[model samples]
Target: MRLADRIAVVSTEDAVRASVSYDQLRAGDGALYWLETRPEVGGVATVTCWRPGEGARDVSPEGFDVTSGVHAYGGGAFAVIDGTLWCVGGDGLYRSRLHDDQLELVSLGSFGDLTIGDGELLAVRESEHGDDLIAVSLTGVPDIRALATCRGFLGAPRPGSGMLAWTTWSEPDMPWDRCEIWVASYSPRGQVGNPVMLAGGSEESAVEPRWGPDGALYFVSDRSGWWNLYRWDGHQVKRVAPIAGECAAEPWELGYASYDFLDDGRIVVAVQDGPRHGLVVIDPDGTVRPVDLPYTSIKPYLAVQGTTVALIGASPTAAPQVALVHLTAADPQVEVLARSEHAKLDGAQVSTPTELRVHVAGDREVIALVYPPTASAADWRAPVIVRAHPGPTASCLLRLDWQAQFFTSRGFAVVDVDYLGSTGYGRVFREALYGRWGLDDVDDCAAVADHLLATGRAVPGQVFIRGASAGGYTALHAVAQSGPFAAATAVSAIVDPDRWAETVPRFQRAHARRLRGGAGRVNAATVQRPVLLVHGTADDVAVVEDVRELADQLTAHSVPHDMLLLPDVGHYVATSTQAGTALEAELAHYRFVMTAAAAD
Candidate 1:
């Protein structure tokens, strides 16, 4: 099939069939419950319940959004309590009766990381002042009591048998940067004692607290340069296993669980080592054994009940799926429970990514996932699309992104660079962009483009770049800094760092100024290549004014460019329809630029 056909299949056909984003995986009452968000349904989060023999069923009511806007990047939106599901809906907490579809609003507040224990549900409620952990009773007027209050934020409310554990951090520091783990005695009536800081400090980031089968507290901390597993043994914190891999996940959103304790003294963990991932079992004695799993990408959401492990897993060729593994079997057996989408394509047509370590400035190495064009023609080199991922802090996982396939199927080599500020590498690599945000990322993108052209993996003078949000800013900055890319496309691009500062949180304002460098305003003379800019009119992250100001600058300089203002969309174009349109427009613009270059 052609590129357009592949795009259509990915955007409509496959998306309609699957389009699932699962999280909040919980096991209780000999069953499992998970939250599934579907873009086809306008990205509404729904709770799905599954029994060993009864099959899966949706417990969420129709027209209800079981999600939280606590951190914008929402997670830990729902909690399953005694077979009943409690979720954050709109501006209130809603509880759903599992047997029937009846839903009731339990409380009036925005909540996340809902934890249930001792006949009560605990959550971190977000408000204008800050975030606090509060307990909502299941009965008796449904009284809400403040369990723990932090000066800045509180989340990951994990209520154990008789103890309550949560993570706290103040502003100027994201959760991944630095967070403290606190534990308190729990009582059915109310909190019994004061919460004590167990592990973590201003320099250390401790997250994902859970109680073992033996009632011991376990968590992941980055005190050893890499995020590793640790346990709080009564008085002090002890290491479960001091492996050099990062088991602690970045808390970009609230409800993430990376590791879980089995009834046996074994703990199953998902570790991020560079671009690859592994699933390992850590015994009580700190012995680690790697479990052979077929999936390449495993989400932080994990749940374990006895010998069963349930997770959201994906491979290089498969979309994200809800999978269950039987750990007790002589050979661990994996069963596919639910899939987001099943794209029917031949194995040969799918391009498997090859991880590359490209050398950059200061003798540093940046990783890039390269996908060769999956086309019949082999003698000719394909034009490359260097896609800089968003989050500047986030790395592109080794999973099947149909959007990348849309270009690869059309005989284009795609390279996703994990530049300097990306996670999954240790804290040092993530902190590489501490004072230099846009410049370092911009250089890394151009460096990868240069490496690809030098190696003849990409066609010269035909390299194109695409990005969104932070990545968009890098794309625009890279194009102006270098002469490698023939054209570039940026969606919700941050063109001016100074103007962009106003849109971000108060804590990031200083870091935003560092992005303002020697690169002055882009004009017709400075930027010679054609550019395409797409911005959602309702984008609140990098406000519309940033794009309008850049458009005005481009117009004043008479630079060749195209801009599209999408209505009602926010910082991200959530729907597949909008994404497909943006992809088509980007490809069309690239073709026009290539044709003009060829004619010249």
Candidate 2:
């Protein structure tokens, strides 16, 4: 098979049709429910329910798109309350019983972080003004009551016992950077009393507030330099089975449940150490024991009922699947609830990632995941691609990434750089990019490429760098600076940090400014290498105009570059029909660069 054909097997529309993404796992009333995002259906998200005897079935009402627009990157869009599934459909909030087709509209608006309250649904509603907490009536004619109005962002409005808990953070700080958990007396009639600051501050980031089975408010805090579980027992807050690894994932979206309570009063928590993820059971007496599982990566959303846990798990060889684990068994067995129809690849076709650490900046070690070429050739160095993950805050996982495999299977080595600002590491490491976003991230990517070339793992003058969103910004800057990279591809790249800060959504305005932190703008004049710029016309986060301006500058400087702008596409291009086209263009761009360099 041709190299392009091997790459197409993972990047084409057929691959998208064969793939599925599961999110928001929730268990209640002896059933497991989750949101399945199918790209074949135009990325329509629907709720599915599965039971012991009965097979899995879609429970979302026909013609209803179960999604939320609260934070733009919506999550926590559905909740199972009293046997009825309440979800944010395309036009309004709706409720329906399991296996029933009767969908009743509850309210109209963009809402997320859906939680079951006392006879009501608690959610965070987004509007032009700002975000606010609201209570929706379960009965009567769609009575929507504002529980709390805040000038900043609000999410995870969990209601338990007689109190309602939620997270709030203002501008200039992302939730992971800084946030507070608040609690208030909640009445069944949708009335809320004065809120009290429970736990969190500028220095301590707290999130994922859940009411424990013991009526204590449990949450995740990074006070000890790592995101660990904490419990608030009416008057005092205390750590729960404290561990060095992060027990909660970054709050990119609201309503992530990293840990859940079992009926036996034990806690099932998903802990992430570097790129690997595993489950640990914490006893009431503060003992933590690892749960043996085959999956290497677990999503943040999980639920526990009795000793049964429902989660979305993935490994190097398998796509993510919704699974149920019975912890009470002698050897806990994972029950496959739903698996994606991905094309099965043999061991020879798969490239497993290994940890690569390089010391830079005078003893500061940088971490990365290196995937060597799966196609073997004697004494031939492979071309390398250094990937800068977006979020600038997010870390690359150990899960099976078809995109990375696309290059590895085609005789290209891929290195995913986990720069200073990336998560999965502790807070100190994550916060290292606070004032050095573009600078440190760019250096890290360039350094990784340098190390690969120096160690003979990468072909000299054939290394390329690529990224999306903030990582795109890093790639653009890296190619502009002195580096071993021969070419660059930036998707939805932030061309100008100042402009990005002004045009980005209110939630991340401060984050943009903080990340930029005294860094100069991208100097297109310094970019001598070929560049490929891919952007979506409808991207609100990194507006298309900025990329256009950068392209104009590159043209003015007589630089060789190609630009691909997809119409009607948003910030994320992974699932779009145009994704395959973009990938092909990128591969061609790199090949052309190599050919030109070899001729010279």
Candidate 3:
């Protein structure tokens, strides 16, 4: 088929991704009125909030750093109480409750955690020596009382009254590892019971423990291969819903896989639906019914305040937007509370992404989803954005990405190719990266690009690569070795194996497996494409030196390159205004190269 029928390549303003820019979430109350922030600095995360009636606008024009400027720690885990937000800031826990939104250390001494428990607030904390569960009163500084002696650390406090329940697990496993679900009684006086263990699965994997209004404990477990719902009704761990053949969402972090609650004897959860997902309520009798959603490719996740459902969601042509819905009450109209103004400003051209099987190198079918260029191709051939996701362990999903559409709007087709090592497809596929990495994924990416070019979706000379961290490495290394991309960009990437081995997080130190094929340095000499490198000087994770070495190597190789070094940025370049602009600049550079290539 000719590219004429395609709406892409049209030289018009409507084909731009400016429809969604990004919103500095002000505040999120009832998921209706709230602001959500990812990064306030190099290693910081913050959220915005506003008082009712006046609106999120009047509250504050700025986001409060929940991490309290601790540069080493990347801010993430947070909880909201009474109108103020409490989170792990820096080394300790801090709360933002002042009119000026100044952060104050609210613990007895060290930083642990503070959460609303049994009508008041309680601090569930962790120290290097061990874990201690403390009780905090929102009326004043919470009285610190140890919870009968915790082992590793207390899980996010299960909000409850009368009888209280919480989960705890040992180290290395994190929270999702095998955990022990404990149920005991609590008093404002901070007393506990002998605590009967309801269900202690593996020592490495149980989380999102929701003590229901029905007096039952609900949590998601992966014991069944798929992370499904498990119920502890004071006895055996029963399978409430045998949800199979699909997953709701892949794990983004410790508590990201799935969040659900027990409302009306029904287990309400957010799960992976086809192409998109949403809130699904499952009855104890085994009937799975979906709560009608207001949008597509999106759904509400966690339930807070017993009534409000917090949503981490997306649209077919837009980025994920955090919205709120009142599920505990009648009339479940999704209230559009907080939005990434960028999501609204960015123009997303909906091109259905289907999985491609460009199988090579191994048993796994290499996956690549193509988003056709958003213009009429009659005038010119198009470019393709080939992305190699980080993690080599990280799984790339088909969710909304403003960055991808940003290029598609600029007359470039995009393919988010999940090389052999990516997750979501299961352990078999994920483990493929173990011994393979650089070789298999690179082969898969190159093959996908070849497949797209051979099939005519991309001009052979115009394929380009862009990735963050490890993905950036893939992009750079691939363009270096083979394939014809006009250019490539690597962000916060691990370019030097030896330097990265020295600085990257100890857990990720195994990165050499991908570069050396389990042995020596994998030279960037294979790359000849013009490369743009982005990194934050403040980065403690990937380290500034990683990209610096890449820049040096690129220069030594005589490769065309431009480097953007952020002053106080870290791994993800979070909360930096320059991030989006820098991304846009990368797109512009791609255009310049591809246009030139086309001219030639």
Candidate 4:
């Protein structure tokens, strides 16, 4: 088979267009509700509900695109309350019965983080001024009222037992950096009393506040150096379970739940221990036990009804699926509800990753998931693609990544680096890149390449680096520093930090400023290898103008480079056509660089 055809086997345009992403899992009164985003229709999101005997069906009306624009990257778009579904559509708020196809418009505004309260619908409404926590009466003629407004941002408005709890953070500090959990008395008439800070401060980050069945407030806190479970009994805050792993993730989007309460006073939580993710049951007495399951990667959002837990899970070979676990069974079984298109690939085409720990500057150890080429190679050595994950704060989980497999099937080894600043290793490790973003992360990527080369797993001069968004920023810096990479590709990369910080949404402005860390923009003049720049004209996060400027600099320096700009595509090159085009262009660039190297 031709190289392009081999790559197409895993990442064809048809498969990309047919791909489906599931998010915001919620369990209603004996039904499961979640959001399904279809890339074929330009990323139209719709609400879906699944019942035991009825099967799964879409509940969102035909013309309604159930999505929230809050925080620019929206989630928590819909909530199920008392068998009725409340959702935020493009026009405004809408509510419908579980099986109804008609949607009743309640209000007009941009909202997210939908929460159910005492006869009210709570959400964070985004406007030209700022974000505000608003409440709409479910009983009356949908009376809308602003409960609280902040100068910075507000999200996760969880209401329980006649009280309200939410999180707030100001500029220059992302929610994971520093945020406070506040609570106040909430009246049935949609009135909020003076709020009091329950936890979180300059030295701590608390998020995902939930009101347990016991009327106590439960949240995740990083005060103990690891994000652990904590409980507030109205007067004092106490640690519920002290696990060494993180029970929560950074609030890039709203409505994230790492742990949910079970009816019998136990908690079913998703825990991230390095690159591996799993579930555990925590008893009220502070005892914790792992839940045996087949999947290795699980999203933080979970929904529980009775003893059943609903989550989105994936493994090395299996694609992400909406699954339900019946904990009451003799042996817990994962009942698959919906699966992604990649699930059709045979097991032989899959490349599983093995965790590798390497030491970089300051002798600090960093984790990297190394996947060997799946194709049979007589030479045994293959070109390596070193990938830096976006969200300098994000960790790459052991899931079925189609992009990674697309290269491995064609005899290219892939290495996903979780550098010094990655999460899942605890708060201290996550904060290690505070003032050393580019320096530490870049060094970590280089060290991984070096380790692979030394072990004879990668061709000495055939190593390449690539990243998107923050990861792309790291790749650009690494390739310019005369690293071991033969070439580099950056997609929607942040070439100018100052420009990005100013243009990005209010929620991530502080993150951009912090990640820059005294480092100036990438000097395209210093680049020494073949560079490929892929960006979308519609990318508001990292504007296309910045990439154009970088391309101009590369041209002035007489550097070998190619730039591909797709029109109308957003920051996330989500559509199948765009993704396939980008992947093909990237593969061609790598092959051209290899041919030139051979000629030399």
Candidate 1 lDDT tens digits, 1-600: 565454322333343334457777877767788888776666667788888888888888876878777755667788776667778887888887775668887878778888777778878887767787888887656788887775578888887777878888876577777889989887666774877889888779899898877778989999898899888767877888988788966787887889988878789999888766778898778899888999888888788978778988887788778889888866899998887764354333567788888898899988899888764344447889898888777887888776677777677888999988888889888877866766788788888998888877778779998888878877887777556898888888777666766667543454465445534334435666678999888776778877887777778788778998887766776342366567778878888888888999
Per-candidate TM-score against the hidden true structure: 0.93, 0.95, 0.79, 0.95
Model 4: per-residue lDDT, tens digit, 179-209? 8999998876667888999999998899999
Model 2 pairs whose backbones collide: 172-510
- Candidates sorted on TM-score, descending: 4, 2, 1, 3
Worst 10 residues of 3 by lDDT: 68-77
Candidate 1: residue pairs that collide: 18-340
Error of 2 at 405 (Å): 1.6
Computed on alpha carbons, the lDDT of every model, listed in order, comes to 0.77, 0.84, 0.58, 0.85
Better lDDT candidate (3, 4): 4
Off by over 4 Å in 2: 1-11, 62-64, 82-84, 89-92, 96-106, 344-348, 375-380
| Error of model 4, residue 566, in angstroms | 1.2
- CA shift at 207, candidate 1, in angstroms? 0.8
Considering summed lDDT, which 10 consecutive residues are worst modelled in model 4? 3-12
Backbone clash total for model 2 is: 1
